[model samples]
Target chain A: MKSDSDILTTIAVQFAIMSFLALGGANAVAPEIHRLTVEVHGWLTDRQFADMFAIAQAAPGPNVMIVTLIGFHVAGMWGAVVATLAMCGPTAVLALYLARTWDRFKDAQWRVAVQGGLVPISVGLIGASAIVLARAASHNWSAVAITAITAAFAYWTRWNPLWLICAAAVAGLAGLV
Target chain B: MPEPVSPPAPAAPIPSHAELFFAFFKITLSGFGGTLPWTRRMFVEEKRWMTDNEFNNVYALCQFLPGPNIVNLTTVFGSRMRGPTGAMAAWAGFLLLPFCMMIAVGLLYERYGDVDVARRLLSGIAPAAAGLIVATVAKMATPMFARFGPAPFVIVGTAFAIGVMRWPLLWVLAALVPVSIALTWWRRR
Candidate 1:
């Protein structure tokens, strides 16, 4: 079993890595996170990772819940605390420091370039995350169908996704997923 | 017809650090899964702490950095409102409650994850998650499309290239950034 210190160190290191690469959102680091959790740390399997991601989504808060879950897996309750704090702390500090000088360069050209440069990269990262999740979760034809249909509905319609989620839940209860 | 002239008024005073902390604390607790748009509504439109342009600019910067986007955003907004202290308060308030909830859920899951009912419940929730991701993509895309003709199209093309064509993400980004910058610059000129 992993020791408490080791777990805390892992959590801190993971968050530090995530803090740096989480460009765009939590999704941006999802692929890397998966690699670490499943491949490197041996903390969880790919399916378990996907399941935790689903839990994070179903929960009514930020996507950072995955950190909590992974932490719990590694070292129980305290691990959860360490992981969440470690994940959020650095970014908060960075944002604070950057905010101090943000106003002075509001109209700078590099700012515009940075903004322009990041949008596509963020989109690309999010898209990559989708592919990774789909690969992990799409174990059966039904799961694949659900993924494709959800993507289609979202892309084409304005229907609130809550209904689809409920429908999927019902289907899963009926052994559809 | 005589033009109506408005009387000159004093500018609003900057909010105090305490007030900024409380306001962000509320935003952090209240905001749920789809935080970006709601954050825009609160900070840019309702509170008027920052202009839409400012929010967009800051959001762009936050995106390139690490961690949860909203957490980064809260820090930036809080720091702007006060200083590092305000930023810490905001981060604490925003994170503390959610972290508690997630831990509780995690504990419960650890205990019962292998139970049949729990398995069924989790399976049921998976599709809902897929739907949520779709919704998020739509919500994020709509605003990007609303501004600058062809920008939306470019975003869509980029999404398709990345999503369906399996294009290398970096290469796609490499191609699109300059194209978007050139188009925006040319249009502005």
Candidate 2:
């Protein structure tokens, strides 16, 4: 019984830490979230993690909803509320304070340098997220083909990504990759 | 891009807390796929609450902060209009409906997640999700590498450490962010 409360507190703390480290956004922290929830805590499976991300992206609102879904999976309604707030609250407050004072440092050299340095780090973190998700999603050659083709279309074309998701679903239904 | 040395016009009329809240509420409801572009349209084109340049400036600040860029934008925009209360209203408006929807989806997934057909459908969706992330990274990476030097090194090193070696992310960032920042600072100097 006590373990249940401990788990909830842990979920809150974990996501709160993730909120600040999400330099490029929640997407940049996906790999870490996957590691903690799936690997360390045994909260969900790789399949479940992948599905939550897919559902979040396919949904009408923010992609950050994935965290909320994962929280729900872990600890019911309270978990959902705690995770959503933990993931967003600190960063929102920080942005509010920083936005007000940003103009004062707009022309500072150090500020520009920090932005320059952080950009690549952010991209790298996000790249790691992509790699982690790819490894989880594709285990067979046929699945690999789907990932490659979809990625090519996404990179080279301006087609809406939702179409690709739908097409993949149809392929799955048809017993094709 | 020089402007005449003239006093800036009076600040734009501030939105009421209700207006701030409902505007975000509407934005969240209509935001399919992504919210950033929709937010720009509402703030700049439709409402004229902020000019394009103003929107970009705020967006840049949000990007610099750690969090979902759009969520940060909501907080910044709301506070600009009405202070802390405004921030709460806007944040609630943006997240409340979507949070409920996600909960519903979570419930549905729990019930049907293991069904064979549902499993097949999710299997299809997962790879596509991976593809989308790859595309997003590819697009973001090009600009970082357009004038390459330390940027590629940081990107490759970080990626290799996390993705290949499976190192804990906290330690990797703790070690690398300082190095990357110092490199940029030195180069600029």
RMSD of each: 5.5, 2.8
Cα lDDT tens digits, model 2, B67-142, are 8878989999988778999999999989988999999989999999888888788788788888889989999898
After the best TM-score superposition of candidate 2, give how far the Cα of residue A143 lies from its true spot, in angstroms.
1.8
Ten residues in a row with the worst lDDT in model 1 chain B?
A: B1-10
- Tell me the number of clashing residue pairs for each predicted model: 1, 0
lDDT (10s digit) by residue, model 1, range A32-60: 67778887789898778888988887665
What tens digits encode model 1's per-residue C-alpha lDDT throughout B1-189?
133232233134556777666666666466554556667776665667776566766776676665688888888877766677767766776676777778888878888888887777677666557555655565666677677664666666665665666554446656876777676555555
Indicate which candidate wins on TM-score. 2
TM-score of each: 0.78, 0.94
Candidate 1 local Cα displacement, residue B73, angstroms: 0.8
- Model 2 DockQ, alpha carbons vs. true complex: 0.76
